[model samples]
Target chain A: MKHITDFTIVRREQLGQHYFALTLRHPGTLPSIAAGQFVEVEVMGTREVMLRRPISIHDVNPAENTLTLLIQVVGKGTRQLATLQEGDTLNLIYPLGHGFSVEGRNPLLVGGGAGIAPLLYLAKCYKAKGVETTILLGGRTKELIPVREAFEPYGKLLISTEDGSLGEKGMVTQHSLFSAAYDHICTCGPTPMMKAVGRYAVEKGVDCEVSLENMMACGIGACLCCVTDTDEGHKCVCKEGPVFDALKLKKWMGIE
Target chain B: MAKLETKIHNITLKNPVMTASGTFGYGEEFADFIDLTRLGGIIVKGTTGERRQGNAYPRMAETPSGMLNAVGLQNVGVENFCKQVYPRIKVIDTNILVNVSGSSIEEYCSVAEQINELPNIPGIELNISCPNVKKGGMGFGTNPEMAAQVVSEVRKVYGKTLIVKLTPNVTSIVDIAKAVEQAGADSVSLINTMLGMAIDVERQRPYLSTITGGLSGPCVKPVAVRMVWQVAHAVQIPVVGLGGISCANDALEFLMAGAKAIEVGTANFVDPTVTVKIVEGLQDYCQRHKIDDINDIIGII
Candidate 1:
C-alpha cells in the first residue's frame, strides 16, 4: 500500500556534476517499489514551495526500509533538496505510480542522462528474476554519467557519451543493442531519445515501455495535471502510468 | 462543542469547510491522504452534460505562490460521473455537491437534473465562474443575465440546494450575486480562480498551453475576501468564499467577511489534509475567543 510517512535522510551523495541522490530511511518496513515507480517528496526548506516534488525511486534498501531519490537540481525545489544532509526527517509518499514489467527472458534497459535513475532498480529486478539483463547508460560527457558502480553488479553495463568523454562517444541508441535481439526493451531519457528508441522497437517488433516525466501536482490522478495522449485517449501519468507501453503512446507511433 | 454547523436553505453541512471543485477530484482521490467523512463537504470536479475530452496537454503551470490551469473541465460528463464516480463518492458521509458546468444553459440544467437523481448528493454548485474554458464558462458568470438564466433554469428541475459559484472577473460581482439570488439560488460561492496568464520569456511563448489559465493560490486570498464581503452584503443568500485559502486563519477572514462557509481550493494541492486542519483551527479559534457559536464570527469585521 502507498503511504505518506516520515523518512530520515540516511545519506546523500552527488552522483555526478548534475545529479544528487538522497537516501531516505523510513521509520518502518519500506513498501515494495517496482521499477518506473516514483515517490512524492516534500521539500522542507520553506513554506513558499507549496507542492511536493515527484521523483523517481533511484534505489531501495528493503531490509532497512530506506529508499534513494535521484534529483537533478534544475530549479528551486531540487536545490532545497540538495541542501539536506543525513539525520533530517523528510516526509514522502512512497512507491507511487506504475512500475516496469519484468516478464521477458532477455531484457535490455536503455537510459539517457539523469533518466537512468529508475532503470537501475529495473535492472536489479530483472536480474533477480534470473533474466539476462543489459543496461546501456548515456550522458553528454563522462563527468555527467551518474553512479556507474551501483549498476555494474546488476547487469551487463554499457556507456555512451556525446563528447567521447567516457565509453562510446554517442547516444545510447548508437549502442549495438539498438539493433540487437532482445525479448523486451525499456527506455527513459529525453523525449526525442525515447521516441527514437520507440521507432527502433516498432521496426524490430520488440516489446518496449517508456517512463514519461510530465510535470505533476497532487502526484495523484485527482489533479489531472500530468496527462498524456495515448491510443486509449488521455491518461493521468501519475496514476495509470509514468511507465507505459511504447506502442500505446501516440507520440511513439509517430502520430501525435 | 462549538457550533460549526452551516445551513444553506434546507441543507446543512457539518461544518463550513468544503474541498473546492477542480482541486478536489471526486473526493475519492483524497481518500488515502485524509478521511472523506470528516470534511464539512466535498465539491467534486466540474461535470458537464456530456463526456468532455477537455483541452490539450500542458494544462497546469506553477507560479511563485500559486498555479495556473487550463484543464478546461476534463471530465467523464454527468452520465458517466453518475455511473463511474457517484457510487464511490456516495459512501462518504458528508455533503457531496457536484459542480455543474456547461457550454449552454441547457447543458447546465441537463447535468443538474442528473445530480438530482443521485440520492446521496445533497446539492449542485452551478459553476458559472470557471475561466479556464473558452465557451460558456466564466462567460455566464461574468454577466448577470447569463448567470441568472443558468441558475433559474437549473433551479426549475433540480429540487435540492442550488448554489451559484460566481466569477471574480465581472465589473460588479454584486450584480451577478444579486441576479443569482433573485433567480432562486440557495447560496453563492465566490472567486473561482482569477483570470490570469504567465509567459516564458526565454521561449518567448505563453506559459500555459491555453495561452491563459485560471490563477489560484495564496496570492488570490485578499481578492477573494474582498469579493466575498461585497457579495455577502449585496445578496441575502448564504455565501461560500474561496481563493488561495491555505490555512484556518485564512478561512477565518472569509467567515468574518460575511461568508457563511468557506471552501479550500488550491491549498489542497499544497496540503491534502488542510481542510481537516482548518476544521480544527476554526474550533480552536472559537474556543480561544469564548465564542460558543461559530456563525457568530460571520461578518464580525
Candidate 2:
C-alpha cells in the first residue's frame, strides 16, 4: 500500500560539502520500511521539478516517529530538496519499491557516491540479526564522502577515495578487500562502478545483488520508466527492484 | 451525489473520470492506493500483437512542470494479456479498456480481434499516436489516410467500442480525428504526449535514451485543451480529452472545451488517487453549481 504523509523536517545535518542528512518526523504510526527500499519525496517548493525525487531510506527511528534520508547534491531536484529547513512540512510516498534480501546468505555491502544512503540501514538490519557484515564505501574524494558515524557500529567500514585523500586511495574495486572471500555481495552506485563490482562477484562465483538508480516519475510500477533490461525481461526498477541479482541483470561485462 | 454517468459510444461509464493509457498500468498496481471501483474506467498500457522490450534506460526525464517518456510500448503480447493480465483486472468491477498498438494493419486487427473475444474487456482504444516507437506509432497517426486505413482495418474484426487516440505531433489534428471518425471510430481521444526532447547540459547528452520522447504534465495542458476543443468541433463522435491533466480543474478544462469525458494521464505518477479524487471533485463541482448531471457541464463554455 502507498502511504502519502506530511512530515516536518526536524533536523538537517550537512555531512560534507555536497551531502546532507534530513530527519523528518511524522505524527502517525510509521509504515513498515525495509533496507534498500526508498521514498519518493515531492519537491513541493518548486513546480519545475514536478516529479518526486526517489531517495533511498537512510534510517528510521520508530519511537521518535522519524525517518532519515542521506542526500547528495546531484541536480536541480536534490539541490531544491536540500534547501528545506527545519520545521518545513514535506510530503512523501513512503516505503516504496522492493528492498534487499538477506535470507540464507552473508552480505558484504558496497556503496559508492549517492548510492551509499541505503547501505546504512541495511547494515543496521544485518547487525541486529547477528550477521557478520562489512561495508566498502567509495567516493571520488574525502570531502565528497558521506558521514560514517551512523554506519560505524553496524559493521566493518572501509573507505576508498580516488584522489588518495582518505582511507585507501583508488576506486572501490582497487581496494584490497576484493581479494577476500564472501557468500554474497550487495552494491549500489554509478552503473560503471556497480558493473565492476558485479563483474568481480560473477568472476569469484559469488551471489551478487545491485540496486539500480534509474530515472523515475512514479515510484510505483505505474510508470514504465526506470525499467532495466534483465535476463527475465524488462523489469521496473521501481517495482521488482531497485535491487536485483547480478546474474539476472544484463550488460555487466557480458552477463547479458 | 450529482449524476456522474458518462457514455462513450454505446457503453455508459459510472463517471466521466478514467485513467489514461500507459499511465495506469493494469488496475492491480494501484489497487492498494486507489479504489479501482470508484474510477469511471481504466485504460491499461499499450498492448501489441508481439511483446516489445521498449526503449533503453533513462526512458524518462523531468522537464519544467512535466516529464518526458520514451517507454516504447513495452508490453506483453496480446496472448499474454489474455492469459495473465485479464484474470487479474477482470475482477476489478469497473470498465477495463485495452489500449492496442501495432506495426502493421494485420497486427492491429489481430490484436483487436483477440481483445474482442475477452468478455470483460468492453473496448480497445487504438493507440496510433505513440511517439516513442521508431515505426508505426506516430507514423500512422501523422497521416490522415494512414490513420483511416488502420482504423478501418481494426474496425472489421474488433466488434466493440473503438476509441482512436490521436497524436498531437501533426500539422492538423482535426483532420486525423475527422478521418478516423469517417473510418467508423466509435469515439476519439485527443492529444497524446507532444514529441519533445531535453538535453543534460552538464553531460552534453540527451536526457532520454530515445533522444525524443513524449512530453506530458501541466506544461502541455493548454495545448491539449486547444486540440481537444478543435477536434471536438470537427468530429461528431465523443471526444475523450487527455494530455497533462492532473486534477479535477484540469479535467473540467477539457470538459468545457468540448470533451465528453477526461482521462488523467501523467497525474497518476503524482498522486495515485487522482482519478478517484477527480470523480469526487466532479461530484462536488456539480453540487456546487446545482447541476444534476455531469454531462450538463460538458462543452458548456
Candidate 3:
C-alpha cells in the first residue's frame, strides 16, 4: 500500500553538518512499509527546487506512527530538506516501489554513504524475522558514514572507510568479510560498489538484490524517467523497483 | 456550486482538470492517492505503433522550478495498450483519452484507429509535439504542413474527439494551432514542454541522456498561458492548456487566457492528488467569485 499525506516532523536530529535524520509522525496510522521501500518527499521552502526528492526508508516505527528519512545534502532538494525543523510539515508519497524480498537463510546487507539509509530498515526487518544478518557499510571517510550505531542491534555491523579512519579500510567490496558465507547479498550505495557486489554474488552463485539510486521525476511508473535496463526490458526504478535482482540487471552483470 | 462541466467537441469533461499525457500513467497508478472519477479526464501515456525503449538513463534533470524529461514516449505500444491496458483502465467512469504518438503518419493513424475501437475511450490526444523522440514526434508538430497532414490522416480514422497536442518550440504557435484546426482537429492543447537543457556544473556534463529535453513545471506556465491565449484567439477549436500547471491559480490563468479545459502535468509528480485539489480549487474559485459557470472565465484575458 502507498500513501500521499503530510507527516509532521516530530524529531530532527542532525547526524552531521551534511547529514540529518528526520523522524516524521503521520497524523494517521503509518502504512505498512516494507524494507527498501522509499518516500518521495516534497522539498518545501526552496525557491528553485520543484521535484520531490526520493528518500529511502531509514526506519519506520508503526507503533508510534513514525518514519525516519536519513538524508544527505547532495543537491538543492536535500539541502532544503536539511533545513526542515521539528514541527515542520513535510508532505510525502511513501512506501513506494518494490522492496527487497526476504529470501535465503543468511543475508549480507552492504551500504555506502546515504545509500545505507534503506539497509538499516532492511536489517531491522530481517532481524525481526529471526534471519541472520550482516551489515557492511563503506564510505570515503569515517564522517561520510553517519548513524553507524543504529544498525548495531539488528546485525553484525562492519565498516570500511577508504582513509582507514574506521573499520578495516578500502572499498566495501574489498572488505575481508567477502570471504565469509552468506546465502544472499543485498547492497545499496554508489553504482560501482553495487556492481562490484553484484558481480561477486553472481560468481559465488549467490542470490543478490541491489537497490539503485536512479534520477526520478514522478517517483511512480508514470514518468518512466527512472528506468533501469534489464534483461526483461526497461524497468521503472520508482515502480517495479528501486531494488532489483542482480541477475536481471544487465549492467550489473556486465552483460550490457 | 459552480458549473465545472465543459464540452470539447462531442466529448464532455466533468470538469476542466485532466491529467497530462505521460504524467498520469493509465490512471490506475494514482487510484491509491486520488479518486479517478473526480478528474475531468484521464489522458494515459503516449501510445505508439510499437513499444518504445525510451531514452537511456538520466533522462530527467531538475531545473529551477521545473524539470526536463526525454522519455521518448516509452509505452507498451497500441496493440498491448488495447490488449493489456485498455481492459484495465476502461472501468474508470471519467472521460479517458489516449495520447497517440508516432514517428510517422501511418503509425499515428494506426494507433489512433486502434484506440478508436475502444468503446470507453472518449478521445485521442494526437501527440505531434513530443520533443524526445528522434523521428516523427515533434517533427510533425514543428512544421505546419506535417502537423496538419498527421492530424488530417488521424482524423480520417479516429471517429471521436481529436485533440492535437502542440509543442511550444515553434516560432508561431498560433500558426501550428490553426493548421491543425483547419486539418479537422476538434481541439488543441499547448504548450507541450518547451525544449530546454541543463548541465551538471560538478560533472561538466549535460544532465539528461538527451542533451535537450522537454522543459516543464511552473517555469513554463506563463509561456503556456500565452500560447493558449494566442491559439484560443486564432483557432475556432477549443484550446486545452497545459505546462507547469501546479495549482488552481495556474489552472485559472489558463482558463482566463482562453483554454476551455486544462491539464495538470509535471505537478502530478510532486503531489499525486494535485489534479483533484485543482478541481476543488476551481470550484472554490467559482464560488468565491459568484460565477455560475467556469466557462464564463474562458478567454477573459
Candidate 4:
C-alpha cells in the first residue's frame, strides 16, 4: 500500500572500492524525522533482487527536499541499488522506525562503517536543536568512510581506521577524545563495536543508546522474527526500537 | 462507514487481519498506526518460563524475495510478561493470544498455567516452530510424538483456546498437524518460517551470526500455501494459514487452498499499516464477488 512517488538519483559518488553515496530526492512533505531513523529503499533494478533494503537516513535537507544514503555494495541488493542512475525512479518507505532520543543535553555520537549514516543525521539534528554533539567515526580505512564532508558542519568529527589509513590509526573508543568528553553516548555499527562503546559509557556512569541491526522481515512488529532479549523481555528492533538505552541494552545484549 | 467483520475458529474477528506474534510486539507498539480494536486478534511474542537473550549478532539476512532471521526465542519469561506486558494489552479491545514457548513439556505447562490466570488473554499459541533454538522450539514440532506430547501437556493446564503453530521445516507437516490435533489442540496455525541460510562468500562466512536462519516473506508464499492445503485436507480442526500473505489476493489464495483463516506475517514489516489495508481489500473482494460471508470462501477448494 505504501508506494514511492519519486526516486531521483541525485548523485552517486564512489567512496571506496565498493561503497558509494547515492543522494536522492526526498518525496512528500518532509516529516520531522530524527537521527537514527531509517528508510526502506526498494531495489527492483534487477530481476535477482526483490525486497527493499533498509538504509539509515544519513542526512536530510528539508529546504532542498533531499535525502542522502551511504551504501556499501556488500551484496547483490546494494550492487543493484548502486547501478540506478539519475531521473530513475525507486520505491522507498521513508522515515520508518524510531530514531535516537535527544534526551541529554550533551551526547556522544559514536558510529562505525555503514552505521555512521544515522549518526551523521543525528549530529545535524542535535546541532540544529542547540544541543552539543560530538561524533566518533570508525572504519577499516579512510576510504571506507562515506559522507565525511557532510558531517563536518554538525560538530567535532573524529575518525579511526583499522589499517592506519587515516585519522587516528586505532579504534574510535581508543582515541583520546573518548575520555569522558560527553555526558551521554549513542552508537550504531557492528555488535562488538557497539558493545564496547556501551560498556565504556556504562563504566563512565553516562547513559548510552545503541541502534540495532537485527535481521528483519517485516520492519513492523508482526513477524515476531526480530525479537531481541532486553531487560523488559523480547523486543523487536523494527517495532519497540532499533534504538535502545545503553543501560537497558547492556542487561540483555551484554558486552559482546 | 461499512461493517468490517471476520471470523476465525469460534472467535469472531472485528476484521480478518490480525498481527502475527513477534511482529506486533505485544500489540501495544502498533497503537500509533492502526486501531488494535479493529483487528481480529493479536499473538504476543513467544513467552517461556525463563528469560532468553537469544542468538548472536547478524541475526537477520536478506534473500532474493524474502529474509531470514534466527532471533532465538528471546523473551522476558512468563512472570515478567504477566507483570508488565499483559496488564497493558489486556485493556485492548481485540482478542489477545499469548505465544507460549518452552524448552520442555514442564516449561510449556508452566507458562500455559500462568497464562491461564491472566485477565484478558483469550488463547495461547504454542510456538513449536522456532528454528533458532536448540532445545525446544522446532525440536518439538519436527517430531510428531514430541509435538503431540507438548500439546497434550499444555492442554491440561491451559483452559482457553490452544492453537499449536506448526513448523514448515519438517518433511511431513500433515503428520505433525495430526499429532497436535490428537493431543487436544483447539486449532492449528501453519506454516512457521522455513529453515534457510545465506552466505557472505567474500568473507567466507555465513550472513547471519547464527549461520542458518528461518526464512519468511513472499519467497515462502507458495510453499506455505501448499502446506496449508495439505494440512487442511489432513486435519479436522481449523487451520490458520500464514506466510508471505501481504494482500487480499494472497489471503484469498490460502482460503481457497483450505485455510480457515490467514495470518499476515512478514507483510507487517513491509508496511506497518498492511493489516488494515488487507482487511479493506478482503471486504472489497467479497463485495465484488457477491460473497455474503467471508467464511464461505474458506477451504473452498
DockQ of each: 0.63, 0.82, 0.90, 0.37
The better-scoring model by TM-score among 1 and 4 is 1
RMSD of each: 1.5, 1.4, 1.2, 4.2
How far out, in Å, is residue A191 in model 1? 1.0
Taking the tens digit of each residue's C-alpha lDDT, what string does model 4 give over A97-172? 7888876787788888888888887887888789867888998888777657777788888888988888898888
Interface RMSD to the true structure, each candidate: 1.6, 1.1, 0.8, 4.8
Better of 3 and 4 by lDDT: 3
Residue A121 alpha-carbon offset, candidate 3, angstroms: 1.4
Tens-digit lDDT string for candidate 1 (B1-301): 7989988777788888998998889887778788888888999999998887777788888887888888889899899999988987798899999999999988888899989999998898999988888889999998888788888888999999888898899899999999999999999999898888989898999877899899889989999999999998888889999999988899999999998889998878767778999999999999999989988999887
* Candidate 2 lDDT, A1-256, residue by residue in tens: 7688889999999887899989999878887788899999988777678888899998988889898999999889999998999989988887888888874346789899988888888888887788867888899998877766667898788999999999999999999986548788989988899999998888788888889998888888888998887887789999999989888875634664
- Candidate 2 DockQ score? 0.82
Between candidates 1 and 4, name the one with more favorable lDDT. Answer: 1
lDDT of 1 by residue, A1-256 (tens): 6678888898888776678988889887787889889988887767567678889988887888888888888777888888898998888876789999876888888888778889888888887888768888888887777778888988888888999888887888887555658888898878888888877887778999888888888887878888888887788888988999988985645855
Backbone clash pairs for candidate 2 read: none
**lDDT rank, highest first?**
3, 2, 1, 4
Query: lDDT by residue for model 3 over B170-198, one digit each (tens)?
Result: 99998999999999999998989899999
Clashes of 1: 1
Specify the poorest-scoring 10-residue window by lDDT in model 2 chain B.
B26-35
